[model samples]
Target: MEEVSTKPSGYKEYVAGLLAGVATVIVGHPFDTVKVKLQKHSTEVEGIKYRNGLHCTVRILATERVRRLYKGATSSFIGVAFESSLVFGIYSHTKNGPQPQVIIPSAAFGGAIISFVLCPSELVKHACNKAELLQCRMQVQGADLIVTGMFPGGSTALLRESVGNAVFFSLNTDSSDPHNLTDVGIGILTGGLGGVAFWSAVLPLDVAKTVIQTAPDKSCQRNPFQIYRRTGVRGCYAGLGPTIVRAFPANAAAIVTWKLAMKLLGIKNE
Candidate 1:
């Protein structure tokens, strides 16, 4: 709990983080909605619901239109806002030294902290609960949805967060000279590629997380490796396309908001 406190960075960093969260939500929710849908539904009903991310987007637009893309935004807004604030607040406090050794572990710690928050938010975003999760949506007519049910796949989430964030924040090593436009250009290039690396590494875990949380069959194995065996490599990478497309702009907006908020708060970038 103390890890989430905004005491470090004079409480301003957390405020900046909240702004960044809103920015991320605004820029990323549609992609996330698609990702969640694909993770949960792509393999259902003979795997014909969505051919790919673009096809999924088109089908949603064609049938349910634009609003469909933002299906879970309301719950997402609260969950992501709080989760982002905690992550950035924790990161700012820990990201003091610019060395890879320092930044990576610190970012990993922040990621570990956020996983607890992310798991439950994931449950809500996917309309999954212990009871609801054990029953298909069609069976939810009178099935009790236990909001307080078991938090599924917590360890898997921890793995994804720690590994993904280590890669995500390591791209910002501070030793580089800003005067060298070439270094900055290289930074941009590596950052984009590294972002892809981060997603590619963890997205399978994410797909597993969704299954553990929302699988309608109670007998479906809760283990991620077992889930992987069932889902296969391609199945687990279900939402990679939209996620890659959204990663660039959405995270850019988050960084922009974080920097702008810090500036407005009269804090120096560390």
Candidate 2:
């Protein structure tokens, strides 16, 4: 069996997280696309864009090509690469550093850094996912669009990241503790559960972010509470089922891949 390293450098953590980001994007992007579509669909419409996750996925596959499901994948790749690198890098650094008790705070700080990468990427990705933009080959305002689009969701993203990261790192740390259990199985289980906890905690914020990001009209970009008022509780959680489903295997794979990559790079958990 491979031994966990007690001391992993920042570079190794970044690289491992980069690999994990790739794995996570490959597994989770399609589901995310569906989630966004569901979130952005108008609740006041006569016929819903999608009834649920399964229906949404099927409709997309049937009407659009398989590639449509991966519309924003490139942007997502870029975002996740930087975001995960910083997150895991900071997380490992703080966890292995002199003051290790501040794991939650370390993760929260990383989450804040993540917004800078995620904001622009999400803008491009969401724009690319739009039918009008796709038909126009994404001929839209460049920097101006990104700037305007990201502004509305900045606070929501911060809250989502801070809370979500705290949940993920804390749960993962408990699960991977040496005294608790043996083998990678624990990591997988804990990682999956961590994903669930993170997403569940941040789903409302995510709903608001999706609304602001994908809104066709600037007027539709409302505050989170405004969105809650308009859409109500059920609408805010429109895609919760699919998100949780995607969270499990996607995060499990990401965590396992990160550990394996770190092992290959000669970094082990202490």
Who wins the TM-score comparison?
2
Write model 1 residue lDDT over 1-270, tens digit each, in one string. Answer: 112232355678788888878987898888887776777676756545776778878878988999888876887678778887888778888876667888889889999999988886777656743545445643643334454344667899999999998888776544333336664455455545556777988999999888877766456587888878887989999868877888876676666666567656655555
Candidate 1 has what TM-score?
Answer: 0.72
Clashing pairs in 1: none
Could you tally the backbone clashes for each prediction? 0, 4
The 10-residue segment with the lowest total lDDT in model 1: 1-10
lDDT tens digits by residue: candidate 2, 1-270:
775566756488899899889889998899888887877773635565677878888988998978888987996788777788888887877674433367788888888878766766666666666767433333454455544645557788888898899888877764243223365788788889999999988888899998887766556656899888988989888777878999998898788778777777777653
Question: Could you tell me which residue pairs clash in candidate 2?
Answer: 4-268, 4-269, 5-268, 5-269
The CA lDDT of each predicted structure is 0.73, 0.77
